[model samples]
Target: MQTAVGVFGGEGYKDGIEVPPLMVANAGQSDRPEISSLNCPPFVAVELCREHLGVHPCDRRRSINEYRSLFPAIDFSLIENDDDVLWKADTREKNEEVAARGLKFLSWLWTRKEKEIAIVTHSGFLYHTLSAFGSDCHPSVKDEICKHFANCELRSVVIIDRSMMGSDPATTNYPGKIPSGLDLPSDVADEKLPDEGKVN
Candidate 1:
């Protein structure tokens, strides 16, 4: 089976306010304007998988629950776990760790031979994780990634069969694709006070 992955950026945030309506608009669902974050809700993610990935209904619910449980608190925050050895590492080390983790995840998923696997994560996660695939890009591009991915934008990476390791034709890399989508609301965008000052 062939496997493909997609990475999407979170919603926008100015200061600490969240633009509720914009967030809904970006998800291609304007009727539900109550969404407060860019990370797709568990139900939505599961629906997407069912509709697009053709996962079984039971399997989709289980996957959604697993994902949601993995990150119980989904508000904006660093991805590193408290026990992660690279938590205190320097910038280079941190980036390397992120990339390693991303590759590892991909490798595991590829083993399943699923047709498509989508990862909805923050911009930093995507940038650092996928840095290994990017060549000769500007240094600033990495830094700007944190800002540019401020909105709920969808980006996809297609790894054709040829690109897989140990395949008949060893294709090392494929062009990373970033798709366009509407803007989402951010907690920071709709807030009047600074994020730090906001009461949880």
Candidate 2:
């Protein structure tokens, strides 16, 4: 989302504010160009979706490489990649697949017990995530959640319950399906916050 990016220390930021740079979570390829232009360091998460899932589009790999070149001083290997979720959502089935991967990936993050994380991913995948897990919310709220979020715009989604997963079988990735002891709540609510916040 461009608005999210702007407030998160991307281009067009107001002067006089010394916002600490946020670590770019090397995720979806769709946002790579925007993230690369953010002028921030990157954390190449192994769980991040590769360019085109290592599939079509020859330029995909080239594009990612260009972004990688922007951060030569950083050691991307320092951060271990996890094989949780990494796929693009092109069709309905593809959406489900990527959404499942996202749930697994997010579950893994919750297992880490980290206080916070900032993820810059494609809008389609993100929509699948909400549609799958956020079924309990009012339709209006759900529509509102999806309606917002322009490219490079930043949004903070608070996962209030780390214990339960959504009731929707389509969205739920039970613990048995993943690594031991990692379970995510099935039902989730988006705690809307103003775009302004500390850079992740």
Candidate 3:
């Protein structure tokens, strides 16, 4: 049995928003403090970004390191860059390709040893991935997930003794289940980028 936790990045500034380099550099720093609280080992952290965004796995690591530097009290290895997985694709195909990739990533995680794992991906991947688990997906669920994603959301779906719990049985929610509003720090600002051109 393992626990799967999904965290979506917060609202980023719009293009031409004129954010300082320091601001852009400091974007994901807040997540580090929050992520350090998890009691999991051999942690599997997945960073899901859109291919068009120009973000890379190295950028994700920098954010992770920033968090670690701020909170050295947290005891857990990052499993190195090799252990980190980056899933990049078009957001337009979020309902199909992105969701499929998210599911495939989760399935692959299940095959590994049972341990607590964390996935940090885009909101589109999170929403659609949970939707694909069922024959019919609901609009309300999508709305709910979208609202959560609007902020820096962190959801958890626990697999209990081989049985998945917390996921929407109706296939309403993506990434299996959507947890309650994440208990993130108040200081953490929303850092999501604006939805410009769709992923082509």
What would the per-residue lDDT of candidate 1 be over residues 99-196, giving only the tens digit for each residue?
Answer: 67666655655665457656665455566655655243334433433343554566666655444434444323323332233122234334533453
Candidate 2 TM-score, true structure as reference: 0.47
Best-performing candidate as measured by TM-score? 2
Between candidates 1 and 3, the one scoring higher on lDDT is: 3
Quote each prediction's TM-score.
Answer: 0.35, 0.47, 0.37
Q: How many residue pairs clash in each candidate?
A: 13, 18, 11
* Residue runs of model 2 more than 4 Å from their true location after superposition: 1-46, 49-59, 62-68, 73-75, 78-93, 164-200
Worst 10 residues of 3 by lDDT: 1-10
The list of candidate 1 runs beyond 4 A from truth reads: 1-93, 136-148, 161-171, 174-200
Please say which candidate is ahead in lDDT: 1 or 2.
Answer: 2
Best-to-worst lDDT order: 2, 3, 1
The CA lDDT of each predicted structure is: 0.38, 0.44, 0.41
Off by over 4 Å in 3: 1-40, 47-95, 136-148, 158-200
